[model samples]
Target: QIVRAGAPYYLPAKIAEHVSMVGELLQFPRLVPKKVISVGSPVKWANSCDARGCANLVTPSVIAQRYKLPDESLPAAHQAHTSNSMAVAEFQGQFWKKSDLDGFGTSCHRDVSVAKTIGDEEPHGGIESELDIEYIKAVAPEIPLTVIYNGQFSLLKWANQISSMADP
Candidate 1:
């Protein structure tokens, strides 16, 4: 029941027309947001979750020890970036679904691949971050997870391509 006409015109007939148009359009297919979970580095996870002590939740070293993964599977957990930190809050999924995600956009495409390292590679926030994976495994091992990453494309290039393809 949206009315585009203002008081200056105060045309009741026009308001009815606008309402009818809106009602008709409502019957068309509407886009509903999808929900997915992801993990990230301790600092990134903490900052995203706005939790102060997320780093302390878990580390790659802990995951390695718990799951018997190879020592080379992750960077040193004691590094300045991996030190004691708070765990990413569980409520992040809802926030992320509605958030612009620091201008990275809200859509997730399957075309990308997840990488083990962040060097020279396009940055992805979800499952691409190693610490994020470790935290997920540590906090909730029961939930199935799928990680995607693509090292060939830079973030800006990927965004540009998506934008261009969508343009008229």
Candidate 2:
């Protein structure tokens, strides 16, 4: 399962909380590192100082090639990376309206259409950047693999909480 936090950019701390909650509810293994994919903006990192933002710097092609994928496979990987960059640009242009850091004040709605679009673009990291689907197809050819994107509600809630706490 590709476990990602609910949106609009859920804080790391709250995501931890949700993970714990879900783990407890399902009696699943507590905090397995391999199962989680932190696709949240890398801007939260202390080392990145670039102004172009997180999406621009994320070259999935470079990453895919790093995995030793063949040269012919590079084109699709590049396409996926370019598509992801475009999607991010569109999202920021359309959604990020307020100049203030905390523009949406309260909880923000998840754009399901956009999320589905991104999923449809298949930005998974593999030979063709369609790794997730391709992997499942190869391993369990008959079984249907469904990609579920958890909305960013918990993320937005956590961000609001953080902003509120910072307002001292």
Per-model TM-score versus the true fold = 0.20, 0.19
Clashes within 3 Å, all models in order? 15, 6
lDDT of 2 by residue, 1-168 (tens): 645445544348857765522221122346756765767754422212223443434232333334564443335422333222212211111222122112111111111111222212222222222333333222222232333222233444434433454321
Using lDDT as the measure, the top candidate is 1
Candidate 1 steric clashes: 15
lDDT of 2: 0.30
Candidate 2 error regions (>4 Å): 1-22, 25-56, 73-145, 150-168
- TM-score for candidate 1, residues paired by index: 0.20
lDDT (CA) per prediction: 0.34, 0.30
Which pairs of residues clash in candidate 2, taking residues 3 or more apart in a chain or in different chains?
Answer: 6-152, 7-151, 7-152, 7-153, 8-152, 10-155
